[model samples]
Target: MLAVSRSVTRARIAARLPIVERTTAGRPTPTRTTKERTMPQHPKGSVLEFDLRGTGSGVLQEVAIAGSEHAVRAEGHPAFGGTDSAPSPLDLVLSAYVSCNQVTATIVALGQGITLGAFEGRVQAELDNSVLVFGAEGDGTFQRLTLTVDLETELDDAAFDAFVAEVARRCPLTQLFERAGVEITNAWTNRALARV
Candidate 1:
């Protein structure tokens, strides 16, 4: 297991960012991590922080978390879009895939002593009934997310393919999807029912 880094500080906090405010009351808001690990989702009122350190290959849309709107602002750069307010959950999912691949690639390449240059990943997912139904066939409720990735790297084809598989194995999103066998947790206050 890689010694993952949890090195974010309050100084690294984008206090003005709306998403930061959404993290108020200790809620984990949605965002990517520095090495690009998308932390598991938390219940409402949590802070989700991601440290983005991807090379400016211009794949991701530039966004900013400025001044307490309680969510990250989609500053959408010229490549993706411009001046959009925020990214939808779907958009974030795609980002999560990208980040996951990047992190996975880094660890896999370094471990194998492979020189990696220009890593890029594109993910395509479908929000349809088939995948969901497949996952929910039994007495479990589940959501299905599938990604088709196009990876560009410098390693040999065989090594790169292995690297991709390795990364996918360790990628947080893939792990959650593969290991999460739908078991919903529902809790609520008990109330007395009056006899009528």
Candidate 2:
């Protein structure tokens, strides 16, 4: 230990000592200054949640939806009747297929660096039943969707056809809906234990 007297104790040091500073042969020590990896935190997540209620059917659920500009649901069905005038699940689904086609077309156009002036899709869904009755099985269903696209970006016919081809390939719900397979598994709940 070095000698320390009463004078050294009373004298104030000119500089503070660094904690365990190492001085290797010639290379300087590495330091992390202002390079810390920090990611920005989102203040809030998405603000959409559809409230689903049981429609008391085999595989049907009533969704009380929001995010519409208006304030009343289209039909006043007690289950799907929201404060706003929007369509029901089936209606929304029909519209979703049409809307999805439009969106997919836009994405396809952007990927190919083309510009679409106007795009509109019209869809008609038929139950094919003689009459509308509650829980009546369909005779056979048929649907037709017509899409009209206007071009202002001056793309050729082949390019436009390619865009439509991509839309037909991609659009999701319709392309996979017919060919999709589903598996249902039955499980008992806590309350079902009593009955069992």
Estimate the TM-score of every prediction: 0.42, 0.44
TM-score of 1: 0.42
How accurate locally is residue 166 in candidate 2, as Cα lDDT from 0 to 100? 67
Backbone clashes, each candidate? 18, 7
Give the Cα lDDT of each candidate: 0.47, 0.43
Q: What local lDDT score does residue 59 receive in model 1, on the 0 to 100 scale?
A: 35
Residue-by-residue lDDT tens digits, candidate 1, 25-128: 77755444556454545442234544432222233334443442234333333334433455643567668766776776565665566544444355554444
What is candidate 2's lDDT per residue for 1-196, written digit by digit as tens?
Answer: 1112233321132122122222348554333224632333443321222323234343334443223333322433234344334465556666777777666655565556554554445655543333333446643333333334333444555655665666667677557444443121111111111111
Error of 1 at 108 (Å): 1.8
RMSD of 1: 18.6
